[model samples]
Target chain A: MFATLACVAAMYLTPLVWMISTSLKPEAQATDGSLRLLPVPASSVVERARANYYGEEAAGGAWKPGVWTDPSVDFPRFMRNTLVVCALSVTGMVISSAVVAYGFSRVRWRGRGLVFGVMLATMMIPFAVLMGPLYVIFGRLGLIGTLAPLWLPAWFGGAFNIFLLRQFYMQVPRELDEAARMDGCGHWGTFWRVIVPMSRPALAVVALYHFMFVWNDFLAPMVFLTHRDDFTLALGLQMYQSKAGNTPWNLLMAASTLVVAPVLLLFVLAQRQLVSGLSAGSVKE
Target chain B: MTREGRENLAGWVWVSPWVIGFGVFMLLPMAMSLYYSFTEYPMLEGPVWVGAENYARMLGDGTFWKTLWNTAWYGAVVIPLATALSLVIAGMLTSKVRAGGLFQAAVFIPTLVPLVASAMIWMWLFNGRHGLVNRALGLVGVDGPVWLERAGWAACALVIIALWGVGQQVMIYCAALREVPESLYEAADLDGMGPVRRFVSVTLPMISPVILFNVITLTIGTLQVFALPLALFQNSKGGPGQVGYFYTMYMFDKAFADGEMGYASALAWVQLVLVLGLTWLMFKVSGRVVHTRG
Candidate 1:
């Protein structure tokens, strides 16, 4: 059992380890016909300035490779664009979903159940069906070739997040709503005074989930954002792969590592919370 | 106004944003797409009503049929393998092992890496001559096929990548596996069931509902797989001979590359029906097998 588990663990982690390993290898060694995880130490420490890339070489410098200098793929711009989209989309999703969830869980209303059901039903409607019409709609709004189409719809409540938040909200005692109302709080007032403070963990889950979603989303950004300047990391990586030059496996791996690092770091730090929250989304009571 | 009336009004106010957005985004587009499916609405031009022509054209469209077959074939192969793999892995994780949480995290970390990045990583790993996969196979003294270049191997490569991201399902299954009562396992032991029989009789039935749910959802997800294949087969749209051409990929190509919006809308509608219909079918079929606690 121990041996089998170890084998599985190695299988799972190999691609990731290879990704990091390949990223650190120089162009020559990266493409060299071997599956070595670590770069071999060069025999000589002398600076081979003339033969080296960029015409500048210190001791052992030629062995080290950096993805930053890739002339074709602008990693910084991709990172910035992706960060902007993530920031806007995550904030929008958290706020909108929470607000809408308040309506579903905190209040008793005539059509609330029916409308909420509609929202949940729409969750089953795949985004593929909406792609064409949405493209047309965004094009009509003159939002094509911009980041607006990527992040704007998030301001509208996503059905899944709204459902998640509503489930969280329902657990908050109804008496809190009543007490807040007794203290001259309206719906907004009660939500601000009572629910938001207590629902911090739930809100964090929603935010983190949406953050990862926006960070990782490809098809939407691919369909909507056209220009090189607006390319998110996912699309930028695709563009990098599709570029006409000889594939720089090292730089490509570096680009991939850069794309994956932030989320992987967050997951490592918050594995407990993320695993619970993610499984909670799927596993029923 | 009565308190109930006031509450109703407030509810509307609070949910107004979602309501409006749902209308504009979901309802409006769905209605418009249904119309577009039956029309000649290219992006640059207005719709011209062409009753059932776009849907009818799918009958003769070889690519449409091929893509649908590829998608169905991919889903049929992937869903079961992935589910079983996750179930087994989750079962292993549930054993009284040291550092189970760390192992779980290791297994799941791949899922957090964006699909595009994962695809790129796999593309390199599936490279014909120098990929780690082929090299490992070579070490075993078996010749490795040019995975990305050949039709069958290209599909196999895609499925392998899909299986790697089964971490999410594994996590769900792990949670479910943990929830199965220890009492049940003890009871199975009392009945003198062997390990395999114990698993089949006790553990399997206990988590059958989760299995069913995962299968249905996996089916839905498999049908809509786009990004990984797109990124993996960047030059080919789909890989050699469009072997990786999936339903959504076809829809994307038709709508964007080919500028055949009306036909793509038809494809989209079919995809929606296929997903919903298959989900419904799974529920109906699995009703006999899925054990729901009364």
Candidate 2:
């Protein structure tokens, strides 16, 4: 059992540790092939980029074909772009999803089930179908170049998140809504004061799901985001993938490692909740 | 009447955002796609009505047929393997193993790696020469085929990569597995039923609802998978001489690369309708199997 646990732990931890190690390695030593898992005199960060050896002939100037290594680290900017898109998308998803879920869960309108069914049905619609139209709409809206393409959809009661929250809301007793109404609490007031307060675990699940999803999403930003400044980490890394020359894979891995860590940590924290929520069909409603 | 009106209004207000979103994001696009399916709509030019040309063109186009076949094959093969593997793994992990929680986490973590990242990992892992797969094969005195470059093997490659994230499905099965009552297991044990018989009679029926959900969802999800195949063949032009190319990839290429916006839009709509229809069919067919508790 201990051995099995160790193996599993090792499997999960290895790639992560490789990412961290590669990120910290001075580019020269990183690429030098002599330095395997451990860093070669790897204590410092800045000096690692421009070493005297390993074909770097100049100090951050034009490089010759065989040997010029322009060692520059854009890790910080990479971090920023990733954070902005992920933050916006996750936030938008949570608020809008909760609102829609609130409507589906508690409200009693005609065509409610039909509308809900339609929304649920859309979940199966492969994004392939939406790709053409979404691009065209965003282009028309002139929202293509910005992060609006990323989060605006969420502003429209994202069905997945809404569904998730609805399932959770259904699990909660109708008595809560009744009691809140008895206290003269309006729907918004009830949602904010009573339901939302009680739904912290599920909300965390939603937030974490969105955070991980948007953070990891490769296709959306690849299509919509045009500017280098607008690059989310995933898209930015895709750009990095297409980067010419030796393709500093270790550094790319580093950026990817960094990009996935916070999200992974969040997942690790909420993994159990996510599993239970999924099984319980909390969002399936 | 007044109370009913108020409740209806409230419901509408609550679900209003979804309606708005669905209209703008989904409905509008669908309408335009239907309109454009008849027209020659490229991103560069305004769409012009061309009648059934696009659909007709799809019929004659070998690549389209190939893409459809590849996607169909993927759905047929991978769905079963992924489902069966996940069910088995979920059962194994959740069924009173020592350190089950750790195994559960181990299984699920791969899905969280993001499809893009997983593809990148597999590129190296599936590389012909220095890849871990080939290395492992060499150690065992066998030569490994280049996974992504070979046609017959490339579809297999994507399927294998897709298998990595079977963890999510596994997680689902695990959750559903817990829902199976212990009494059934106890009764089976009392009757001296073996693991195979016990699982067949008890576990399968108990988790049938989830099974239905997983199959339908998995089909839709797998049908639309773009990143793995896209990423796997990033430098190679397309998937294993387009042998591994699936429907989404075909639509993506048409829309983004080929600039056949109307055609792509039509294709997209077709894919959506197909998925919806299949899901509805599965729901209908599985009615006999699924136990809906009142």
Q: What is the DockQ of each candidate?
A: 0.72, 0.48
- Cα TM-score per model: 0.94, 0.89
- The residue-by-residue lDDT of candidate 1 on A22-64, one tens digit each, is 7766668777878776666643212221222222343877633
Using DockQ as the measure, which candidate wins?
1
True contacts kept of 2: 0.54
Leading candidate by TM-score: 1
RMSD from true fold, candidate 1: 3.0
Off by over 4 Å in 1: A42-66
CAPRI-style class, candidate 1? medium
Q: Which ten residues in a row have the lowest lDDT in candidate 1 chain A?
A: A44-53
lDDT scores in order? 0.85, 0.74
lDDT per residue for candidate 2 within B1-294, as digits (tens), equals 698898899999888888988898888877878888888987888999999888888888888888788888888988999999888777777767788887777777777886666666666567675455666677779999998788877777777777767777887888788777788899999999999999888888878888888898888887787776776677343566786677888887788888998888778767877887888899899999887765
